[model samples]
Target chain A: MAHTIANKQKITARVRRIVGQLNGIERAIESEVSCSAVLQQVAAARGALGGLFEELLEDHLRQHVAGAHLSDADRQAGAEELLALIRRYAR
Target chain B: MAHTIANKQKITARVRRIVGQLNGIERAIESEVSCSAVLQQVAAARGALGGLFEELLEDHLRQHVAGAHLSDADRQAGAEELLALIRRYAR
Candidate 1:
């Protein structure tokens, strides 16, 4: 339904790396890494996650909701779908 | 490189739908849609965006970061990548 079929591998790889980063943070905490350095690492991870978000958002905007292919009814459904998702996301 | 290359079309579609949803919001505002109705629609759109984010995050986790293919060095780089993204997201 989404791009998951085509890009599952790539996405998984990024996430796994995030996992490692989390591990790295654990190690940093154990080693008593400086607050600034640790914070930097945390920030980096957050930024990376954002990148993933941006990529997906961009894709969604360009193809499904406003793409040339969709009919008016489909478009309304799309909006409804998003509204549904937002409810879950907020939870 | 993220999964954009492989799933650009699918991702784009989702984004386009989100745009439509935004348009709907504008229309509702112009019509003076009820507060509850407008708020619900707004919430829906927000939730939809979150769906896009979740999809990307899931992929990042499954394919790129934690996948079996990457080396430790690559994994670390992935975390660094996320960290970089987080900084931008916060800004």
Candidate 2:
């Protein structure tokens, strides 16, 4: 719906960039980059991936769980899901 | 620390149940709840305030711009501020 139109392109671009980053990480590992340098890239890629998840989660809440046809239970469930996600990824 | 002990008590109990659903929608429009049931509780309190701004922008992008120590232009400017907040709150 409206949300999809607003975010589809940006999300697609992010995913594409993340894929490239992952490939680059593989190359780094294969070439035996210094441990610290390789770890830095790994951390950066993780951040990008987390950004993707965050964007999608926000869109889902704004369009489906939180803003659309749903019961109070659904809202609570969505909130719980969000909490769980934050716990899992941010830790 | 540690994602604020895993999401700060479920986002403070969803902002205290959305402030009791905005004081029950201002007492259901000052006690004259008739216009389509007060517009369906004002569209369910605007979907629980868009699920508390989508769980605080997904815990600030899984803890500060996609997993911390950000670069890559702050992860694409935090994905263009989440596509301009899903195009201003899903239209």
Candidate 3:
């Protein structure tokens, strides 16, 4: 949480770019662009979103799961949280 | 491409929902929401994007690569195109 707060600007910028990509996809579809072109844009957006997820996942692991200061219970909870997230993301 | 044109409304709706999800993420960040909650939203958006990609990929495969009417050369070209797209998407 603190890590995210510290990196708020960076995260926000990434989110903004992803939003723009999604909008481009919507516009392409609305205008009946070539399927290949629209697929390319969708892939780009997915990749960008994956990048953001990886960044957040790394932060969460460092702060919550792998911190040297965390107790056993806290680490266990963090592991469960991460596992649940991975399952959802994989779906 | 024909497949996409036929399903334009469906694809557009998915894109619109994804855009809304991204906007929600941006707003959550602006409001200083919990990292876990933000992460959940991000994962949901990623999953949605993945679903769209899978849909497009399947359509491309069926229409371009796997059509029985296609010649060997055409299938080869489709395979190459799909390979390129998968590489990009995987990255």
Which numbered prediction scores highest in lDDT against the true structure?
A: 3
The best candidate in terms of TM-score: 3
Candidate 2 residue B42 C-alpha distance from true site, Å: 46
Q: What value of lDDT does candidate 1 attain over all alpha carbons?
A: 0.52
Error of 3 at A63 (Å): 1.8
Give me the runs in candidate 1 sitting further than 4 Å from their true place. Answer: A1-90, B1-5, B80-91
Question: Which has the better lDDT: candidate 1, or candidate 2?
Answer: 2
* Model 1: lDDT of residue A16: 52
Comparing 1 with 3 on TM-score, the higher-scoring candidate is: 3
RMSD of each: 17.5, 19.9, 3.0
Which whole-number lDDT from 0 to 100 does residue B80 have in model 1? 69
- lDDT for residue B28 in candidate 3, whole number 0-100: 89
Cand. 2 TM to true fold: 0.42
Better of 1 and 3 by lDDT: 3
